[model samples]
Target chain A: MKPEYDLLVVGGGPGGALAARTAAEQGLSVCLVEKRPAIGVPVRCAEGVGRDLLTEFMDPDPAWISAEVERAVLVAPDGYRITLEPSMAGCEVGYVLDRKRFDRDLVMQAANAGADIQVKTRAVAPIVKNGAVAGALLEQQGSVSEVLARVVVAADGVESKFARWAGLETAVPLSEIETCVQFLMTGIEIDPGATVFYLGNEVAPEGYVWIFPKGDRTANVGIGISGKKCRSGSRPIDYLNRFIKSSFPEGRVLEWVMGGVPVCRPLERTVADGLIVVGDAARVSDPITGGGIYNAMFTGRLAGKIAAEAIGRGDVSADGLMPYDAGWRSSKLGMALERNYRVKEYFITLSDEKLNRLVHSVSQIDLAQFSVLGIITELVRQDPSLLLELRAIRKLL
Target chain B: MLLIRRDICGYCGCCVSVCPQGALELIDAYLSVGEDCTGCGICARACPLGALEVADEA
Candidate 1:
């Protein structure tokens, strides 16, 4: 990497890759850094993205597309299954990706776009000049160096550090974080075209377990337990183990992955003087589902575009960078994040009985949309008494 | 005191985001604790792998 660039992006996930690509494409000198030695190893995601959203970034490549999902099932606590059509499956059913290849493809695109991509290079601290983040103190192969830039984009994933070092409180609270674990196992009987979600506190308190099919008999079986609910002997892995034992008794383990996701509202501020934060780093992941790839890409691209515009105008202060923050907050993705956070807060308080009833009610409806609001609307239609609780979220839809 | 069982740690950085003090850092995929850690045990509870533990003051 050169001693400096117009834009410096930290992290190699979809967010950073997109940020680097967008900024570089806009004629800015860009450098993207990933602390991991390679891209997309130790896959942290459940490898699921909506078909519509996936198509927006790149056409599905067979090498990275594990499954072309057509249907989804929601298994209630009492074992009542509700089958959802692909259109009504929300964001969970679309494409179960092989993220190991998918993530690399994105970074390759950024590299092709003229951004200098560095692997295993970390930004140990932010470089501030004149009280603004000008660049980062980067560490590469055990040696540290100063790399200056006009703007620094913190696209780091859930464990975002550069933004914190630059003076933003990005810490996710215990109640707002999901401690997750996933196992890729084969020999399990699963419909390759369908993904499944099992909901119940007993199985995963304040969270859910999922089966994202990778193939006919192989899938990413994962559980996300609320961090606040995780206790000794009942951690996320323990719950996932119980699920594997019951659902895929003879499945052979292929891989194990563990991580955390922020299921909270977007950060109070995602931009600072000469800085912008994107994706999970900005707490832009869906609060209910904890999905973030699309959000990350969306914000990453926006940050790039706005950064270029701000620099063109000869201003890179927080005020000049406010457009990146404002642009996303009003977009469709931002609305969903806000709506999902509220719905998540409400749903987490529901007993399994309420969820079962709601799931049963929605299963019978020909819902126009498959979002949380759609389910809530149908439930309120069946029982008018829920209008009070539904009214708050009703306004958003 | 706070203790980390590196043997079982997957180094996914789950414990870092929830630290109120911002006392934990995940660099090079390695979980590191800073001097500000008060043994609050929040990271221990947030760890999905149960790799962190906190001992009460004597």
Candidate 2:
């Protein structure tokens, strides 16, 4: 069967939902499809977001927040710690969200905006006509159907087939992908005010381990290992379980989430003829930190706004949507993402010993007086030799 | 046509970072070559962005 709509958004995650809502608000008839049975089921995120990053798009609804974070603790491999005060940390200083509520809330907003949400509907392929993407073919409840629209927004996550199917070559290499495993645990005494980050190859190997407090007693303890490193045989979960046993031995496990993050740079082109890809699908997450929600939401808003304007003008080609890409590249989200990608590459190349030493060096500095970016830039400034070391190290990449 | 995704490129300086001949350097959050890229495509693949592409050099 063929269903027609003004805008057909594939994948009802944050990006898709927001796109649908924004498009609908612009008076476009919209339909959002998701493969999952519900909006937020089978949570894939680390369940953390910065308060400042979130404020630009929408207000923090009390229903979506799980905890309020006030500080950050940067831990070295040898257990040295540098605490970050909220004011210096910039945005994201105050949130450990309940992603279930967070994801549901975005979709709820879309639904309230008059978009048709289709759960358990998987977008199998892009519908094309005259060599241009027109919409998508969806598999709903074991039956296949076609949905047609003037524009298609591909918001499918890291394993985004739609983006590839739509003709944009968005492939994340193994080295750039961080395989992550998280456990929601209780019985661990953690300060709700602070989120802890542990950096060292011995612990995570090219990535790091994070402890994001959901409540005073419960936390999402997780570890991320580079996929290239994992090819040698150590798994993310194995490392995470080992860390838990050694660090929070008394903590009780409540839930688990295994996922991958694209920590590489962003895609060169996010737009194709008659189609736009957003969020993880477009590699919109932060490379250094692996954070995507803020960037994803920001990109989604731009895509939605651009798509609405294009549809209204009846111009839905690649040329018509170039503004979305240009606008995003100039935004603060884009600037930070690009800078972080460079820093992440520098970080992953550090040897275990260098990492430990760097962490030790950082732990001694007063983080409250400097931004994370400022601290790293200072580290590079303090040791001109380290720049040479980094240059020498680049020979391996 | 060689296409590079800008967002996924990790400026690890590896493409230019690890070039034995000093062919690459980071310029404004991206790795660029100094008229001697060698068309090796090493930087292209070494790039987490998959941003670098060795095309016709045209």
User: Candidates' TM-scores?
Assistant: 0.97, 0.83
For candidate 2, the lDDT comes to 0.76
* CAPRI rating of model 1: high
Per-residue lDDT for A33-123 in model 2, tens only?
8876788866767878888778877999888888888888888777778777765535247688888888888998998999889888888
Chain A TM-scores in order: 0.97, 0.94
Question: In model 1, where do residues sit more than 4 Å from their true spots?
Answer: A87-93
Residue-level lDDT tens digits of model 1 in A135-189 = 9999998899999999999998888888898899988999899999999999989
Q: Considering every candidate listed, which one attains the maximal DockQ? A: 1
Segments of candidate 2 deviating more than 4 angstroms? A87-92, A363-369, A389-397, B1-58
Clashes of each: 0, 16
Alpha-carbon deviation at A187 in model 1, angstroms: 0.9
Query: How well does candidate 1 score on lDDT at residue A384?
Result: 86
Best by TM-score: 1
Task: Report the TM-score for the A-chain of model 1.
Answer: 0.97
